[model samples]
Target chain A: MMPGSLRAACVAVLRRDLLLAWRRRGDIALPVLYALIVTTLFPFALGPNDDLLARVAGGVVLVTVLLAMLLAFDALFRPDLEDGSLEQLMLAPQPLALLLGMKILAHWVSTALPLIVIAPILASMLHLPAHANAVLVLALLVATPLLSLLGSVLVALTAGTRRSGMLLALMLLPLCVPVVIFAAGAVSAAQEGLPWIAPIAWLGAALALMLILAPLACAAALRIAIDA
Target chain B: MTAENSPSALLAARDLTFLRQDEPVFGPLDFALRAGEVVLVEGDNGSGKTTLMRVVVGLLHADEGTLYLDGAPLDRDLARGRLLFLAHHLGLKADLSPLENLRIAIGLYGCREAITPQQALHTVGLQGYEHEPVRQLSAGQKKRSALARLLLVPADIWLLDEPFANLDREGIALVNRLIERHVAEGGAAMVTSHGAVTFLHGEPRRLRLSA
Candidate 1:
């Protein structure tokens, strides 16, 4: 196949996924709603102490977003696997890793983009300091794609199994630890008026590394799942 | 069409074997498919007909075998643009309309020339139902929607598993016509069915698998 055609294939997969997500916009809203509800419940469960809520707000938002993102992960490859589009993907002339990268990008656009946009509302709802909001969103911007990218590999591994939600979470949660730590740590530092760019930069670095490796791993895992 | 008599294989398998749970599914089998020819694979349940197609499409790796495409060792990425595999699942996204599904399928496989999704849908007898979501289509229509890929995409080899399964008489005839035109144009196909159906064109070779 021509190089131009390969690039066209990637764009086609990306557009197709985005169009599908747009058609099912209700499903896309669930994760954002979950983030909002969970973030709102924090202050109620811990009493109305602003200091206490604000102190833990960074960690709370990170954990909530992570959990919300996990909800979408179960769906990343399930629809394709069930309908056999995954088999077509494997057989495409384009490199599987390149094709999977487009899919991960689409997943982030559909699921994680909304969470990042609304995260500050949730953060402020939890009484998180106003100054830390930008850093929180920035951290989320970097970390959420990391979550989608890393989570996709696990999702691909479990795509063929029935009831793979719990298995996907089990496989993915451990891998998300560093991203959560760095993102939450950045927000907490910003809350304390410290220079927070270092941790956020570290998160970016990790994301860059994941960008290079996650798609390849996910593609390999998809092949295994299909062959099983 | 002259390549049909050229004595060269378009697709060839040497000592192909696949195992599930360490037991052989089908193995040590050798076959060659030439241009403008059809090979019908027959087998009983669990006899590995589907597995063989899966292996041929590179969805599953043969445990021990060599596969060649057009006289060269098979490199899936290089050979992919030349092949299309239609399995039992149909590969349609239920939420998407037939037009959208065909567009995506054609785009992914990289069409040889500009062919509108509408034209492909029309050819597949889905003209009136182009915008209906696949879930709303009857089983035969869904299969036809998937079959639109054969008309829209440029591929020389087609691997179909139970292509006649869910189709009514007319739908079955549609598949046979597609196969006939494809082989007549020098494309090759391998189809698996429980029993044989009359081909409208070239003589179809048969390969039977034993459990």
Candidate 2:
């Protein structure tokens, strides 16, 4: 059994990662800035048709946030792997999955939390209706953690490989389809004045399932990467 | 030191064999480490010395063998708290100061005797440079920073890979002194080094792996 309390270990890992991310504020801002820029470009690309922008805004924002998350995912384990901190983590008395889960939580806080905070502004800029705004935020709230969890598995799998960014994207995109579909479906339902709760619930369910399975899978993949 | 001179083996490997890509890398090796002892793994370049340490640390799985900790089959959860492995990589983040790094390290795998990060840095001769980013430190300093974990963390077994590399004469002597103190205090250390290490306490037992 692990020596210390699991809660304490998880908290320590989470706090340490957050502090490290705080020190490198510029790196934390990259994904949020990327999301903002990507959201802003949609209006120009589709010629400022408010209806068109609103119609696509839900899907567009989810896609851009995912893309931004992808940018952050590639570096999730890279720094730890390069600097040998990952090996120490493996040696921790706590379970590797627990530690990895904490890292994923910190990633969401640093990368996705800001995006969630700014998402309403992006929604308004896209002419998304006020009714759908709450649904949009809710969908993203459930979906981003799922994305971080799933993305962590992929990142762990590709942790030690050279030039893994493109490889990570390829491995992650197909797995992310369900999140995108469910998240966008919820917003689309809200846009059409239909009940949006079902899709959001589905997103939550997927997040729950991933919460159980992803950390263990990511830990196994991390072992493989380190051994390789 | 209550367990000093105890014959009971703290760590043991039986017929331990590891393979890479369907071929045996190192094979069917047997060794035992007891409390209050130091074992130097003597091997030439690419003789799987590092791999052996990695296997012991659970970073790599053994293809054909059993490892025992305290006479039972090794379980990672139990082994982790009792074992500390310092691999070839120093494991220090370049962006973080030595103090920050030590705090995280101690928080994750706690020490038996609680000592602050500052004290650990001072123990490693990094007193004045506690707040400087590790990237700014020389190779020897970085290695010393990593070595501080041995002092700060509480573990019975130490698997050190090239602990003497990149150290000045004084730094090498420092490592020797630390290992001597650790072994004398009922801890066992297994170290792999290209250069000969002159132990301050006594000569370390040898385990040679041939490629």
Candidate 3:
């Protein structure tokens, strides 16, 4: 019996979550499908005007991705909390924050990565500029993770409570305002032929901060959830 | 457990009581468990048996009183990797197989000196269902899968809320055998049940909780 190290624990948890996500491959597709349907409707709703679609394309993709991410938020920690796996995770010897960080990483990879991969396609479908496509993807690359990290803390707080799906949306959407602003700001700036680096840099700074703090908040919130 | 440590009580409780909504759930209780000892916690329904077990494992903080491990105050940091808890929830992932579940536990708590996940599953009577998803297993088999975790983890203290629940006669005997082997190896355990267990090693100490 080899003693498990902190690194081993992290790897094990990451692999476990990824494997579970892979097994439930259909669940991973729901958000992508949701994003696909939502992006497809923008043209039909407001007429197929290229200017209108192009103007709204950056904002549309950002909000669509954010909302798509929200669709999968319930899967973040609720299942683990209900099945007692979260309790086991808390009881592990390693720092709870580190383990949760791993979980958050897996969540971003499975849920948001797919949406990001399809983002340019989704944006281009709305007539978003070809030159602005890189900026859109780059902004999403930073913004999606920030949303995931922030959403994890809210998910942790609402765990173990019934009817949390709506509550999660109500609470998370307000907090998502800033993330959406910076991300959409970057994309729009790029489309308007302006320097878009500042907003993306802001998103990066916030991501760095949340990447450190959100997991610690999740650890504390979940301990309280389990305690109660 | 580190070497060169002095012999002392593995676990001790002093006026340890838990309250819910300002109502007393359990004691103001006192107890101590030494190495190689098993304390049988006997209580009636809603008599704080599970509550006591949760407090012992630090899942729920005591409303009033202190708990000590190896003669030092029990805190979250110290209690982790040292205490193993198996309550009503087996804590296994339904989507993963028993083997994968055991591997996750091992990854968290580290393995015991000489046991592998496969060996632990075999010890717990889950030899043939190593890769079967835990959701497909029956209630007793799920419990057995959790029991495999007890074999693989290296924690020194075991707090089993109800080891006999949802088990057949052979499963009960299997649990007793595991406890006996665990105790003989100088590990301490506190088990709660409805007084149906008959130990093979003569008799164990009983800690009764009164409502």
| Best candidate (score: lDDT) | 3
Indicate the worst ten consecutive residues by lDDT in candidate 3 chain B: B1-10
DockQ of each: 0.61, 0.53, 0.68
Clashes of 2: 0
Shares of reference contacts reproduced by the candidates, in order, are 0.67, 0.56, 0.68
> Model 1 Cα displacement at A160 (Å)?
2.4
TM-score winner among the candidates?
3
C-alpha lDDT values of all predictions: 0.86, 0.86, 0.88
Q: What DockQ number belongs to candidate 2?
A: 0.53
On residues B1-211, what C-alpha lDDT tens digit does candidate 2 reach at each position? Answer: 2321234889888889999998777878888899888988887788889999989988888999989888888898788988888888888888888887777777778755666667877887898999999999999999999999888888889998988888888888889888988988989999886534533346777888888
Chain A TM-scores in order: 0.96, 0.96, 0.97
Query: iRMS of each prediction in angstroms?
Result: 2.2, 2.5, 1.3
Q: What is the Å distance of residue B96 in model 2 from its true position? A: 1.6
Query: Order of all candidates by DockQ, from best down to worst?
Result: 3, 1, 2
Error of model 3, residue B78, in angstroms: 1.9
Residue A42, model 3, lDDT: 87
Clashing pairs in 1: none
What lDDT does candidate 1 reach at residue A167?
A: 76
Instruction: State in Å the error of residue B6, model 1.
Output: 8.3
**Candidate 2 lDDT over residue span A102-145, tens digit each:** 99999899999988888888888898998898899999999999
